[model samples]
Target: MDWAKDGRDWPNNEHSRFVACRPHRWHVQAAGEGPVLLLLHGAGGATQSFRDLLPLLARRFTVVAPDLPGQGFTSLGTRQRCGLAPMAEDIARLCEENGWRPHHIVGHSAGGAIALQLALHWPVKSVVCLNGALGTFEGLAGWLFPVLAKLLAMNPLVPRLFARLSSTEKRVSDLLASTGSQIDPRGVGLYRRLVADRAHVEGTLLMMAQWRVEGLMSRLDRISAPVLFLTAENDRSVPPATSVLAAAKVQDGEIVELPGLGHLAHEEAPERVAEEILAFIDRIETKKPPKVSGGS
Candidate 1:
């Protein structure tokens, strides 16, 4: 769809901006000013996931949330780059090209994997994953979903058909509710808008088709930056134990479970999520002792 036609209606206009970089034109939104924080929404969702959370985070940091290439309003430059490794490289390149240095990176679901991928190349201070897709698919979904996505992505008419079939209010609501998340009307509305766009749907399917995380499981230990997994107790998507198991492997990895929330914890309770984020950032900063006046 042509998102430009309705750009004014998107949330957080005060801080929203677009930057053109090689392979993609990024739709980025930001607020406040201080250390840079990059917020990445899960696959299929866009910046809307952080609508309520951004204002809170912006209060303490220069929060920058962007629509990933091929998802949301961001234009996908090359379909091949939608995979995990390439997508992460493109994101880092975007930051480098735009001169935005993120000290902290926050990601939800698939975006969480992207954040971890970022730590491999960038000098980020920390990374946070909420209901992250750290584990591989299992059971019926494991065998069925990716196969369906690949078939749909390969078909030229599938995106248009899928968008037409899933664009209604009820369909969008059902999709979000299936995640065990209870979101407000505004959050639902943003999703409704996204589902109607054919390009967004196409991009989502393409990314899903190209996505890979199994390779990262073994390499998680090599990621240098500290990582935090903020899990929602009621999440049906990625089990809470995924974080527990992952934290066990890394040197500075940790997990915090938020009671009564689901996969979309940020959307359901932005205030609480922001509280945890602030505490995490504070702890990271506090660990460093003050330097002497002329030490260097």
Candidate 2:
């Protein structure tokens, strides 16, 4: 699939594995051997977003990260399938097919929203959101953004032209820079490749067009699983207040604020991000008592 290859320069090509998920061919990276921990990247990103944190996380628990539909190496399905609910359902299906009952679900940006959906729809122990997109747009943007995105995705030529026009290394770097996150060269390189690909760009456009969060936000209390919102102090894409407010609404939500980092905290400082996650997981596990022999 074109999503898996950009003229022989696939993102995280070495660890890539393909699975036939209906509607899309999934490219996943699985490692470690303990309880399941699913890592989900944001829109326009693949498994490589977790390149640094995965190995560290793998030491304590099994880690699985997959490219979302229409992004990374996953093939784009219909527009309907790209909507928030369907995207979550499809991910759940993928997990069911692979026998991965995520003991913990962690997501970045848009992926965090999906984690919430998974918690609501599946049996999950806990959820972690890294600068999650949990708020609705405001004023004219609330209406204009999705409208423009839908128009672009519907036009076959627009994505191709946009990819061609904005796929340069400088452009990719600038875009990443705008997020206030200082990504290393390697991380920026991966995004550079993604911007150059028409399929990936199209998939991103479709995702934006179908992205909806108001309904999910309205029912945040329905998410029974405990949640951890990790907010980067310098995040320019999604404000830290967004996470602070989101954490307040969930039944069991905790907020941790980190300074000197941006939206891509995992990418910028994997060690710090992984440290918090490990501690959070350990705390949750420690709270559980051991199984008693022959006890009710």
Candidate 3:
């Protein structure tokens, strides 16, 4: 995550800035001039994930996309704070300190879970999840994934080894393919650069090790903001049904499926994903009761 070495040609680099938010130095990208729209990328991803989607959304709203602590260019403050609740709390603090009140929150995968957690405390207009990882793994994977991640995260050498092993174009392509998504060469290159960085890989492992959604899922019913879950039809990472079931629990939640897409639907079809998010937010705004003023 060296800005000079790795971020010279980064997507939307013009909008990138570093802010000293306690416990971490946040790398944030902000643009446009309307209501604040917060974009959160999934695990193992960075602001680059929204390369195309950001521009589309920026045209209509002021968009802010930040690299999660310890991931991308954001330096990690505390290892334990990589979990869902702590991440949400830290992000909330980041926003408050910077005077950015997110009117709408759009999150992908693990980011979606974090968005929901934020909604429980923050008064956001709506929550849009693109293939959110809202449910626990079924059967054996339920317990094994976290345990495996914990072991890898505990070992200091695993990340370096993983980075070295996954430093090829084919390796990155295959990894993305496993999620049932296909992206252009530039996208693949960005992912390759990320996986090749030991720090980024380590951050992703720490996040996976500490992530848990049970508490957040239990409180879905409490979120006053409308929640829109966008599930990709061909997603292989988290099943489409996960969103369906999670949406059912929320006070005002709905699900939309992106046909022929995958776990990385936003990257695969940024236009389509942007359209859904814009449409959803527009509907929410239109439904709100108009402001009342007292006549003098």
* lDDT: the better of candidates 1 and 2: 1
The regions of model 1 sitting more than 4 angstroms off are 137-147, 288-296
What is the per-residue lDDT of model 1 for residues 97-147, given as tens digits with 9 covering 90 to 100?
878899999999999989988887788899998878887643333454577
* Residue clash pairs of candidate 2: 3-73
Question: What TM-score does prediction 1 earn?
Answer: 0.92
What lDDT would each prediction earn against the true structure? Answer: 0.82, 0.81, 0.88
Query: After TM-score superposition, what is the CA distance of residue 45 in candidate 3 from its true location, in Å?
Result: 0.5
In candidate 3, how many Å is residue 260 off? 0.4
lDDT of 2 by residue, 154-227 (tens): 67787787778887888888777766789999889888778787888778778888888888888888888888
TM-score of each: 0.92, 0.90, 0.93
Q: List the residue pairs that clash in candidate 3.
A: none
Shift in Å, residue 97, candidate 3: 0.5
Task: Name the regions of candidate 2 deviating beyond 4 angstroms.
Answer: 1-14, 136-148, 288-296
In angstroms, give how far residue 120 of model 1 lies from its true place.
1.5
- Candidate 2 vs candidate 3, lDDT winner: 3
